[model samples]
Target: MFSIVVISNATMVPDEAAIIQQLFEDGLEVFHLRKPEADEQAVRLLIEAIPAVYHNRIAMHGFFHLMEEYKIHRWHFREEHRQETTKEEMMRLKNKGYTLSTSVHDLPTVQRLTSLFSYVFFSPVFDSISKHHYKGVAADDFYLEAEQKPVPVYALGGVDARNIRSAMAMNFDGAALLGTIWKEPANAVENFKLCKQNVQTY
Candidate 1:
């Protein structure tokens, strides 16, 4: 198992591209650019900020129109965005060689969606570090269902270096962190190192 982190859901961080570039340098396998409220130009500027070489590892969360113009090879759909898409639309995206992923908050949803995505973000495996009110579900709830799914189920929410190994041991194919990474963007590389170090423990 490995690890991933969703970028902050808010506006761009200072020296954002540099920080992201460093994450890539630190061996980040996938970079999720989730800008929930960014306008087209804002998204454009952010993508432009990163090097072209890293585009393939980027998974987009919004501003899909940019996909046509960028070389980004992966996409992420929240449940709301997912409701608007059809199987045919998904197949079309796959035909283009693009990969798809989405977020689900529960075990049943992950089971139902097992065949639809390259992977799914099964969230709040622990209480959210970014959203204090969002307490986590039992990790066993994730392990039990994920063990049966062919598709990868990434443990999202509250994962950090401390518990990443436990998450992998619980049957998550990988871990996805938000607050742990965003909490200190300047230290993101060292932070990612911490998670990977835990992963290596397994």
Candidate 2:
């Protein structure tokens, strides 16, 4: 089954907590808190704003402090963040009970990451506003690469209610969205519902 994962970009102008709550209410399985530029204080405020009940359902990306404080065991780490880190370091993080996820833009990177993390996000399968000028990989190409991957692969970038069915038809384990959800926070619930419906039908 495909799932909806929201990528909360801290750089967006409007605060999306209310929409996030609605998504939570509507049954979003995982919320990836991915505000890379936000300081520790800002991230804490965001984390605290979320209701306690949703804490276990949501996962913080790159916020180790939140993990320690809230007992969140899932993390999404970027390639650059793990560049100098060794396998021992990754094992240490895993030993702490964190289910680590990472992003891979190419096959070589995907090969290197399969043994290190539980899942991988192979992105830009479609044009993305979050990463301007990033030419996306063709859906067929992505599928071909992902079919060989040892870990489950998620299709990220430019995913929304409109194209979610197509994403599922391509056999992605799941899909992740950033601007599509954050851009219209007030409509988040409906958007997520629509995407979920499409995913089911596809």
Candidate 3:
């Protein structure tokens, strides 16, 4: 089965931690805690709201220092942060058992990725649902054989129940959901289950 990852809404949402905990309960294995506008204290409060048992399933996008207190071992770096992080720091994280990941927007970058990353998000596979006018490449142009990719790639933008199968058919290992899950926060769990069922039944 193709993996399905849920990315936290970029801004804080009401009952966000509770919603996330429900996602984990419903079999969400990977949750990216990506709140770009939030400060360390805000992020810390959010993390503190979630039960400790589910902490390990989360991948911290910023404020990585919280990982120490929460026992989170997964870390995801955006393109800029990935470029700024030195190899030595990454190695140290690796030695400490952190599972690292990063994002890319083009095929060349995907081909150039080092084995240091466990996986990477290749985004905007479809026009972004969350971000206005952030276009995705043509599906035909996006196709890259497994041999051409050095790291496992998960489709990141505009992914929802409707197009997850297409993403997998295009050779993506998985699809990550942001908009589809949070478009209507009240329906988050239902939307996720629908997306998961869509892939599983197809």
Could you say which candidate leads in TM-score?
3
TM-score against truth, every candidate: 0.93, 0.89, 0.96
lDDT of 1 at 128: 84
* Pairs in steric clash, model 2: none
lDDT (C-alpha) at residue 72 in model 3:
96
TM-score of 2: 0.89
Give candidate 2 misplaced runs (Cα > 4 Å).
12-15, 139-142, 145-147
Which tens-of-lDDT digit does each residue in 1-202 have in candidate 2? 6777888876633556777777889888888888768888877777787787887766666667668787677877787877767789889888877788888787667766646587778888888856778766755433544546777778888888887777777767788887687667777678788888887777
Clashes (N, CA, C under 3 Å) per candidate: 0, 0, 0
Candidates in order: C-alpha RMSD to true structure? 1.8, 2.1, 1.2
Q: Which ten residues in a row have the lowest lDDT in candidate 3?
A: 137-146
Candidate 1, pairs of clashing residues:
none
